[model samples]
Target: MEPKPASASRVEVTHLVMPGDANSLGTAFGGMVMQWTDLAAGMAAMRHARLPVVTASLDQLSFLAPVRIGHMAILVAHVTAVFATSMEVNVEVSTEDPRTGERRRCCDAYLTFVALDDAGRPTRAPPLLTESEDERRREREARVRRASRLALRTALTGA
Candidate 1:
């Protein structure tokens, strides 16, 4: 398959935080935020492969700030790198202040998704092409993350 630029698989989603999705503290529930983060990552992976994808793992999920009810939660996801059959997706989430229109990053997450064929077996995803400096940097950082994951897995399983 031909390589595709990162922009081709970039996805941005915004949702209004509701009271039903928040905790007693009036901040968005962690589960609710994770749901949106996974959706954004899944969309980006699907766009890159044009095939059905399954989430392999979620890494480095951090809740940096609170998202209040009635605020807008914005998430941006993109393919940082494509392995043989898996894509590494990076998601950045922010909260928008309705009154002042200010935005502050609230979360950062990394997810791995594996493309699947019609028979449900893992399939190769198109290579990710980096066009800009930022994209290239992301790709490089993704490589390091991948290495770290493998190292941890090997240490735990002795495989």
Candidate 2:
């Protein structure tokens, strides 16, 4: 498979936080943000793989701030690295105040996705082409994270 540039699979999505997405505290629900992140990450992974992809795991997630109702939630996602049939995606979530135009990072997450073929089996994904230093750094870090995740899984499953 031809290597695809990370820029080619980058995705940015925005959503307005409505009452339905908020909790009794008037802040957007954590699950809502997670859903948006998952969608954005999935899109990036599919773009990179050029095939249907499924979420394998959420390797890391951090909630730094709360997004209030009536704010705009912005999510940016891109492929960090590709490992055979699986790829890692990083998503950053921020909340923007429509009136003040101020943006605050609310959350960030790393998710793993597996590309699937028409037979619904895992398929190889294209290699990631990291052109910039930041991209290269992210790819390197992703490899370390992957190692940690694999160790944890082995410890838990004894496989």
Candidate 3:
């Protein structure tokens, strides 16, 4: 497969934080944010892999700030790295106060997705081309995170 630039698979999704998606405290629920994050990340992975993809894992989800109802939640996702059949997607979430146009960083997450072949087996994905310092940094971070996840899985499964 040809190497594709990170920008080729980048995706941005924006949504209004409705009342039903928030708690009584007026802050958006974690699950709602997670759903949006997953959707954005999945789109990026699918673009990179050019096939159906499935979520393998989610990592480094840190909710740094609260996104209140009536705010606009924005999630940006891009392919950071590709290894064998899996692609690493880095997602950043921010919230904008529509009235004032003020934005706050709310969450950061790394999602792993595996592309599937027609037979439902893992399929190799195209390599990621890091075009800038930021993309290179993300690729390096993705390697470390992948190692850590593998180590944890081995420890848990004794495999």
Candidate 4:
């Protein structure tokens, strides 16, 4: 398959934070944010591969700020790298205050997804073609993160 540019599969999603999405402290729940990030990342991966994809792992999920209820949660995701059947996706989440129209990054996450065929088996994904210096840097960093994840898995599972 021919390599595709990361921008081709980039995704941006926005959600309104309601009371149900928040905790008693009036801030959005961590799990709710994670769910949104995962969905955005999955969409990016599926768009990149043009096949069904499943989340294999989520790493480096950091919650930097609290998003209060009534804020708009914006998630932007893009493929960072592709390795055979899997792809790395980076999701950045920000919260926008409707009244002031101010936006602040609240969360960031990196996720790995595996493309699947009709038979539900892992399928090869197209290689990623980074277009800018920032994309290239993200790809290089993804490689290091993948290496670390592999090392940790091996150490824990002896596989």
Candidate 5:
């Protein structure tokens, strides 16, 4: 069977921070941000793969700022790269203030997800159809990001 098709636009998911999702300081926990990352990335992956998918790896996650209780956390995910059975999804998390409705970036990450079959095994994803200049541009930019990641990894491991 063929894989499903990815959306040309982004998939944005939003969550509100309640008491349960906070830390002792009443700020959102990093683990919670990570969980949202996986969820948003998986959605983007499903769009890219046209099938159910699972996280293969999270290349990097950086928390730039803290999210407070009563803040609205939004995740925006987009397809960054596509391989035979996997696709890289980039997710950005931002927080909106409750009173003034101000928004600020909180975190960003790159996650790779692999399509799965009914048995929950890896399966081939659909080839990305770049129908617009924007898609081509995004793919190119993703390649650059991937190269930068590899270089950084090599430097860190001295490999």
Candidate 6:
């Protein structure tokens, strides 16, 4: 693969964490965070590709910190790359504590989505515009993640 100039597309959403999103441990549930991640990533993909996109895979999700109820949760997502009909979405989750007003990263993840046609079948997405150093760096990181996921799939499927 030729190394072209890298560029990424990104978006962010922020909302207040509610009691309904918390678990028995008094922290936001993993599933709830994952849900917001998907939404943010989908929005990013749609903005970049100008099409309806659907989740094809969630490559990985890691929880680094806890988000308490009544905190402000911010979800940021970016389109890291495109492989055939699939686009990789990298998402970061952060939270601002209501008590201390301090912000911290709570989760990070990579998700893959496929653009859909009017008929709901997989379709090609627009190429990402690379225009900055940050975009290039993200593309490099995406390449590494793509390789890792490929290796993992091969190991699991033995194919």
Model 3 Cα lDDT, one tens digit per residue, 1-159: 789999999899999999999999999999999999999999999988889999998985789999999899999999989999999998999999999999999998998999999999998998888899988888898899999987887998886
What digit string (tens of lDDT, one per residue) describes model 1 on residues 71-142? 999999999999899999999999998999999999999999999999999999999988999888889999
CA lDDT for candidate 6: 0.82
TM-score of 1: 0.96
Against the correct fold, how does model 2 do in TM-score? 0.97
- When 2 and 3 are scored with lDDT, the better candidate is 2
- Models sorted by lDDT, best on top: 4, 2, 1, 3, 6, 5
Q: Provide the global lDDT of candidate 2 against the true structure.
A: 0.94
Q: 4-96 in candidate 6: lDDT tens per residue? A: 222335688997988899999888998999899999999888877777899877976789998888899999888878776678888889999
- Model 4, span 2-47: residue lDDT tens: 9999999999999999999999999999999999999999999999
Q: For model 5, what is the C-alpha lDDT against the true structure? A: 0.81
Rank order (by TM-score, best first): 2, 4, 3, 1, 6, 5
Please give the distance, in angstroms, between residue 5's alpha carbon in candidate 6 and its true position after superposition: 12
Give model 3's TM-score versus the native structure. 0.96
Query: Best by lDDT, which number?
Result: 4
For 1-159, candidate 2 gives per-residue lDDT tens digits of 789999999999999999999999999999989999999999999989999999988966778989999899999999999999999999999999999999999988999999999999999999998999999999999999999998998999987
lDDT, candidate 1, equals 0.94
Candidates' C-alpha lDDT: 0.94, 0.94, 0.93, 0.95, 0.81, 0.82
Q: What local lDDT score does residue 3 receive in model 6, on the 0 to 100 scale?
A: 26
* Model 1 bad stretches (over 4 Å): none
Residue pairs with backbone overlap in model 2? none
Deviation from native of the Cα of residue 32 in model 3, angstroms: 0.8
| Selected candidate, larger lDDT, 3 vs 4 | 4
